[model samples]
Target: MGEFAQILRAWRDRVRPEDVGLAPGLNRRAPGLRREELALITGVSVDYIVRLEQGRAVNPSPQLLTSLTRALRLNDAERDHLFRVAGAAAPSSGLVPRQVTPSAQRMVDRFRNAPVAVAVHTAIYELVLWNPLWAVLFGDPSSQSRLERNVAWQHFAGSLPVTHTPEDDEAYSRDLVGHIRAASGRYPADPDIPRLIDRLVEASPDFARRWKAGTVGELRTSRKTLHTEQVGDVVVDCDTFSGGPGDQTIVVMTAAPGSEDEQKLDLLRVVGLQRLGS
Candidate 1:
């Protein structure tokens, strides 16, 4: 294998399955994530991963490199090395910082077994890291496409699983647009931000109107009723914190203590990622 392939494999072998919200099942041979698991997280095909690891795929795209770096939980230096080895320029400092720092990752890891749902998002709302309980509560984000992984795009162009009052919905729409606007200002050198805005403006007239209206606000604490087939409706208190490196935000969702919602959340933790058969 080439140096790039060897290094990639070694890094992949270092990341445990549990660290990325996968169940560390008993009877496992290797402790690290499987190639298939990495493929799933990076939104790439298993065959592609195989080709890359076999040295058949040379000079992988920066997008793929970034995804791999995140999936393998590479540190900043490792990320730069991955880029350089792959014949791609390292991500510029001016770009919106997407790498979830080790400290931020540890913060997410600490809540792996907690009943509260937690997730980390980039400045532009790209879903980065999340816990198993978050998967149980909000569905598996890894299953979504890159664009689909974006919270802003999902909120404006697509439907959220959560139900909101009309007033709350309006306020939330404005708030989301405001956050996007703020992100655009903060990461002016980022190409993704402009592309995202253009897509949103084209796809949703509401977003276009909001963008034209110049909504500019950050995400704040809010309440929403999340509906899932497994748990029905769960009223969760959503709060965003500046936890990760750069403009990343850690989102935490919790139910009222001693309430039925809280009990349901606990039940979700027990249920885990097991899908019930019809």
Candidate 2:
């Protein structure tokens, strides 16, 4: 095998199934993540993964590289190496970093059974990583494409089940646009940033107007009501914290202590993903 394929298989063999949320079932043939499991997590076909590992697939796109980087939990250096081997340029310091450190992944894993829902977003608002509670709270984001995973895109152009008052809607829109604008300035080298802006400008008149007005604001703690089929309507306090490189934002959703919303969240946690799927 070529150097790229050899290292890819080595990395795949080193990562345990449980590390990526898969159950460590009894009597497995391979020691680490199987080809199918990697395909499932990275949203690439199993055939493609096999081809990649065999050095048959060449010139993987940057998006595919990003997916694999996240799926294999590659650190910054490893991520850059993956890019170099794949004949792609690694994101520079000026670009938004999408690499999720092992520590951050552990942090998210810690909240797997917690009542609080957590999700990690890139500088440009792309939803990169999230916990099971996050999936239970806000439908599973794994099925969404890279562009569809963006928070700003969902609010402006996609049908996200968020209910807000007129005032709250106005403020939230401004905050999202402001953050996107700031990210654009910070990560000008990231092509996705400008493409996202252009798509939003074309698809969302509200976003276009705000962008034209140059409304720059900070993300603030806000209350939002989410309508879920299992839990009905639940209100949550949405809080964001700066995390890792690339201006990644760690968002936590919690309900007021002892409130009905809290009770609902607890119920959702107990119900879990299997029940939600059923």
Candidate 3:
């Protein structure tokens, strides 16, 4: 089994939906941390978190681990335990699987106006089925191996290809990464993310300095300034929805009304479609 898988199992078994303050429900199949619930608490997407727990991803970063830890509400003792589970030296890059259940997939489809995505508590955000605009806005980037299309990586790495000042770039990166940080308690042992941490520390002084200061906790809503080539700058409100197979979250983001987000969405969608076209 992958390192994160064991840790994921531990996280799942140790948590009850309501223990983390989620309402109790009767439809859960995975027992704990439905990928969507985990994503909501951890501020990751259900799809991404699912892969981390299932061993689909091989590496995750320490910062992301911290986020998952925070989201899961694990104390320092439990946090350390997760690190041990992931094997101090494994990569932290993992992807949540994309098999949305029939009902869940229908729910995603119904979220037509929302730019929604799902991730696991482990910080794996998968584009289960996004709206048409979202498909374009968060288009597949060449910068990623099929694996790196995870939204968090795109926004943080500043590789989403939106044209904006460096100022916007930094803010986008922070929120993207911060959301992951917020969910640290659940997915402490992702595979490739640890290596990404090493790279970020080596590459960006800003992230290097703030990496240690990451705020960990159950994710709540936050604002992000985005730079879309089409929409100059837009502030988006990210809302999280939890409950699913277990402990996962589906995060739906919408630009505040009157924002250029719609235009930006159109642009991203256009460009993304072009890329997908080629």
For all candidates in order, the CA lDDT equals: 0.85, 0.85, 0.55
| Consecutive 10-residue window with the lowest summed lDDT within model 3 | 89-98
Off by over 4 Å in 1: 1-57, 60-64, 276-278
Q: What is the TM-score of each candidate against the true structure?
A: 0.78, 0.81, 0.44
Give the RMSD in angstroms, all C-alphas superposed, for model 1. Answer: 3.7
User: lDDT by residue for model 2 over 125-244, one digit each (tens)?
Assistant: 889889887887667787879889999999999988788878888888898899988888777787888899999999999999999999876677788898989889999989887645
Model 3's alpha-carbon lDDT is 0.55
The model with the greater lDDT, 2 or 3, is 2
Query: Residues 1-278, candidate 1, lDDT per residue (tens digit)?
Result: 88899998898898998777677888978888899999988888999999999999988998899888877888889999999999999988898887887767777887866678988898888888887888776677868887998988889888778878888888888988898898889889889999999999999999999999998988888889989777789999999886347679999999989999988888887788454211
Candidate 3 per-residue lDDT, tens place, 44-153, comes to: 67877778878887566665665566446565456666766655532223332233333443454455434433222224443333445555445533334534655554
Each model's Cα RMSD: 3.7, 3.2, 12.4
Which lDDT value does model 3 have at 135? 50
> How high a TM-score does candidate 1 get?
0.78
